[model samples]
Target: MRVTFGRHKHPRFETYTLHNGIDIDAPLDAPVNAVHDGTVAFADQFLGYGLMVILDHGGKNHTLYAHLAEARVQPGQHVSAGDVLGTVGASSVEGPGVYFELRSQGKPQDPLEWLAREGH
Candidate 1:
């Protein structure tokens, strides 16, 4: 499942380091949709991630979507892939863009593996 964004800029310029997942270059206000079916485990601001959403896919697997312009989901809410969870935006003064990640067993993991395995 390929995620889409609008002329999105990569977050490589930002100092905040991200763990894993696809980083789409979506301009501010672009709609950010879910990449997979899961439950919203976290939907709020963090020190670096800014406005973000974390979805739990069960079996200790989860995904983190960050640097959002707006968050539409909430903790404990269920969401499926392609579900619009928020809008991409400049969450930090550092710059504008998204920094996504994937995790397993409470640790960050390579999103490329999951994405490739799942044929995204």
Candidate 2:
């Protein structure tokens, strides 16, 4: 996990609340993969999120991929762990990298804990 969830000061906001996910540095257009088996729930441009993809891992668990250069999967498409979902990119609001999050019931969880448990 590169950037963790926490308070941050922003030039415009004065004080930014928290990061919803971890940021992983990657080259522009580098492939982004799924961490678990799931179906693509969303794939489109989201406000402030840039190009993004959201995968539903069942049990209300989900993974979000942001700042993507391109989305490879579509809604309802089944994907397995390690399957490529998109390529990393940077928008005006962010830099070249992938913003990742693991959520259960819509609540963000520590990705390192989850990755470690999964033997990543």
Per-residue lDDT of candidate 2, residues 7-114 (tens digit)? 567779687778778888888999999999999999999998899999999999999999899999999999999999999889625468888888999898888788
Instruction: Please list the residue runs of candidate 1 whose C-alpha ends up more than 4 Å from where it truly belongs after superposition.
Output: 1-22, 92-94
Taking all chains together, the TM-score of candidate 2 against the true structure is 0.89
Task: Pick out the ten consecutive residues of candidate 2 with the lowest summed lDDT.
Answer: 1-10
TM-score on alpha carbons, each prediction: 0.76, 0.89
Summarize candidate 1's per-residue lDDT along 3-71 as a digit string, tens digits: 332233446864544334556666788888787999999999988678989999999988888889889
In model 1, residue pairs whose N, Cα or C atoms come closer than 3 Å (at least 3 residues apart or on different chains), thus clashing, are 8-25, 8-26, 9-25, 69-89
Q: Which 10-residue window in model 1 sums to the lowest lDDT?
A: 1-10
* Candidate RMSDs in order: 6.1, 2.1
Give Cα-based local distance difference scores for all models: 0.78, 0.88
Task: Report residue 93 deviation for candidate 2 (angstroms).
Answer: 3.6
